[model samples]
Target: MALIEIERVCRLFEDPKRGKPVIALDNVNVRVERNEFLCLLGPSGCGKSTLLNMIAGFDHPSSGTVKVGGHVVSEPGADRGVVFQQANLMPWLPVWENVAFHLKMTGAPKAERRERAQKFIDMVGLRGFENHYPSELSGGMNQRVGIARALLMNPEVILMDEPFGALDEQTKMDMHAELVRIWRESQSTIVFVTHSIEEALALGTHVAVMSARPGRIRELLPIDLDRPRDTTSAQFNDYKRHILHLLRPESEHRLEQAA
Candidate 1:
């Protein structure tokens, strides 16, 4: 059975001025296997983030459903952890406290929370900075804190919505490697949203290409490239070309017409 399943999910926004609802996702369907790294890639304004939000239970679909671990998701829970485009950390708290914020919410002991946070802090390469505040960190370092925070939850799936979008290219690449290593070591399923094709190709075991507004899934491509993927390899380029073609306007028009 799939670890996460999005079945014919659709999200619509009602605009009173337009006298009609705006469709965000149109009959989107996807199944994610356990331990799989799935990337949702598309143009800006596409429903990729919307879909991720639905899976995270931060939002609901207008039609259909999202199921994880054979349970229908109705609200946000510990089973799913989310990392947003911005690293939304508490400015007043130190790194370890921020990482263990969830545990703190449930009234975990101070020393226990600190110990749990340290494990993930080290996992994300943020060991020595546990006592530092968010303001004391760089963008990349803050993002690492965000990642460690999510890992500390030990959720079944980690949903990342452009978590690395704000970083420098070099820093983003470094984070991608760190993320893959973490994913492997933690054995957690992940659903990532991104606009960068290279980022998707570099990190995903499977890439789901999504359409523009009134968003719908266009294609689901599997990446069989070896680990520590060679981005410059011919096979990688071939897959990139395939993905580029799927994201092209003409391809979208064809799919819309077919629908």
Candidate 2:
């Protein structure tokens, strides 16, 4: 059975100027199985984030169903953990405290919170830095803290909205490797949202590409590459070419040579 299911979901937002609801998504459906690393890929404004938001329970679909682990998602729950582009850590809290913030919220004892957070802190490779404040950590390390926090929840599903989008290229690549390793070890399903084709190809077991505005699933392609994927490989390029075609307009692609 699928771990996360989205069926005929659609979202509409009010347009202040137009005084009417604007369609953000229309009749979209996708399913993620347990332990699958699924990437939601598309251009900006295509509602990939919107779709992810629905699964995260940050927003509700105007119509249709979103079920995770067989229960319909109505609001944020501990079963799903979300990591956004920013780490959103508490500046004053040290790494472990920040990672175990959810525990604190639930009134878990300090000793247990520290103990539990330590396991995932080590999992994300931030073991020794457990006492360092977020301000003291690098962008990548802070993001690790954010990831550790989510993993500490031990959620059935992890939702990442371009979590590595703000990092430098080298750091992003390193984090990608760490994430894939962590995913394998943890055996948790992940739904990562990103506009980067290369990033999706590197991490996803399957890439679900969304169409332009009023977004719908344009395609769902399984990635068959080995770990530490080589973007230069012919198979990689073939997938890239196909995805690029799906994302860009024919006229704009033609203009690439002229420029």
Best by TM-score: 1
> What's the lDDT for all of these models?
0.93, 0.94
Candidate 1 lDDT over residue span 91-201, tens digit each: 999999999999999999999999889899999998889999999999999999998899888999999999998899999999999999999999999999999999999
Best by lDDT: 2
Q: Per-residue lDDT for 70 in model 2?
A: 93
Give per-model CA RMSD. 2.2, 3.1
Residue range 1-259, candidate 2, lDDT tens digits? 7999999999999999998999999999999999999999998998999999999999999999999989999999999999999999999999999999999999999999999999999999987898999889999999999999999988999999999988999999999999999999999999999999999999999999888888989889999999889989999999999998878764676699689
Q: What's the CA error at residue 15 for candidate 1, in Å?
A: 1.0
lDDT of 1 at 107: 98
The TM-score between candidate 1 and the true structure equals 0.96
Against the hidden true structure, what lDDT does model 2 obtain? 0.94
